[model samples]
Target: MQLKQALASAVERLDAADVGSPRMNAEVLLLFVIGADRAYLYAHPERELTSEEAARYEEVLAQRATGMPSQYITGHQEFWGLDFVVSPAVLIPRPETEHLVEAVLELARGVQRPKLVDVGTGSGCIALALAHELPDAEVYAVDLSAEALEIARANAARLQLDKRVRFLQCNVLDPVWEKTPDVIPSEDFSPSRGTCCSEFRDFDFVVSNPPYVAFSEADKVQKSVREFEPTMAVFAGLHGIDVIVPLVEQAHLALKPGGWLALEMGYSMREEVVNLLSPTMWEDIRVVPDLQGIPRVVAARKQ
Candidate 1:
């Protein structure tokens, strides 16, 4: 079939399946199948689809109809102007997380070779992006799931940042000092570093987009996210602060004196997050809004 005809049919199918933004999704899927950009797709609407290309398009459309994210179907996502490989193992990079990266880069400008760590570095998006922009810094990433780390490692290599960013299989909730003494020490560890059940330690800056969606809010997420993405990367406890609270308390101990901790929270949890951290432990605790003007990132400095 002609490319235009196939594109029209795909859009109709997606619409009937209740996929939001059907036309745009169809265009993007077509671009992926044909290995062409939007402009190319438009310019060559009459171009005939080979049998293999048609088959691939059909397969992708089928997945899309089931609410699988387009990025996962395409096996790639673009963030901060760079492309990263994505899979079901990791959370797809979101535009809102760009604010976290920007805030970190802005703060790192004056520091030399700043030691930075990304907690819950799903797909190593934030860590790799920071390392790519700040080549002088020592960037480290940690995630609890090994499968997620595999995708993250592949993404780092694809971006040629393997040497700059390091990925470790570790849980941020556990006290890291006992397991990784070389990085964090027991004596230097602060009492406020969460429950101190896990060991790990000092970084110049700590940033994360930890799981903040409450279990009750799961059904409210877009079908593309709730149905296909990993749930471990999405929902937290009843208040959605189960992870964030521990991270905030521990991040204070993990960061160097005056170092910054940047966190991405649910749009409505800014005030609660600010109130959770003690003023004595973190100075200049404030929330920054995302591009949509919703309060999204909360940043503070270790005193």
Candidate 2:
């Protein structure tokens, strides 16, 4: 079969399955199988596919038909114009998260070598991106899952950002208070080890796209997300503030006076997130909309 014919068939199948952006998905899959760019595929529409190549194309087609995300099948995702390796271990970086980065950069302006922490740093997307843009900044990322952290570490190495970004395995839900002088402990403690009391110090900035999907809204999510993506990165709680509530409080405690806190939240979560911030802790609280004009990012400053 010719490459063009195989691509057409794959796209048709995806369309039949009601998959959005079928043509784009088909083209990406074809490029993956043929190891060629879009130009090559267009210039050689009549090129014949070997039996092995045809079989591989069919396999990818089947996966896509089942509603698996294209990025997961391709093992890579683009965020902030840079490609990062992705897998089932980590949530695929979404375009909406770019706004969070932009908001952070806007706040980072004029700040010298700012210290930033990305809580629940899945795939290290936010932390690594910030480190790349702000080479002098001290960036630290933490996640509860070791498997997710492994992928994050690998991506940092791939982007040659291993030296700038640090990864730690941490469960943000657990009480972080260690028996020490500081408010937030500077030293890392193993979860297996007994908890200690340490003062948690303030950070220059704190940013996150923590899990905010409500349990009741699960049916509204797409199959690719609900099934393939990790639940730890998705569903929050009955009110979807399981992570957001604590994260906001933590950011408030972790940020130095006047430090900024920016977060990406669900479309229907703007008001709820705003309410999450107390007047005494956060000032200038506002929700920013994304390209789709949905209120997605909430930004504020510590008082």
TM-score of each: 0.91, 0.92
RMSD of each: 4.9, 3.6
- Model 2 C-alpha lDDT per residue in residues 1-303, reported as the tens digit of each score: 998898898889999998899999999999998889999999999999999889999899899989999888889999998889999989999989999999999889999989888888898999999999998998878777788888998999999998787666666623344443332322344444334222234678888889889988999988789999999899898878998888887777677899988889999988888988889788988788999899999999999
Among these predictions, the greatest TM-score belongs to 2
What digit string (tens of lDDT, one per residue) describes model 1 on residues 1-303?
Answer: 999999999999999999989999999999999998988878888999999999999999999999888888888898999998899999999989999999999888899989888999998899999999998998878777778888988888899998787666666635444454324322223566443334245678999999999988877888778878898898888778888887887787778799999989998997899998788788988788987899988889899
TM-score of 1: 0.91
Give the residue spans of candidate 2 off by over 4 A.
173-176, 179-200
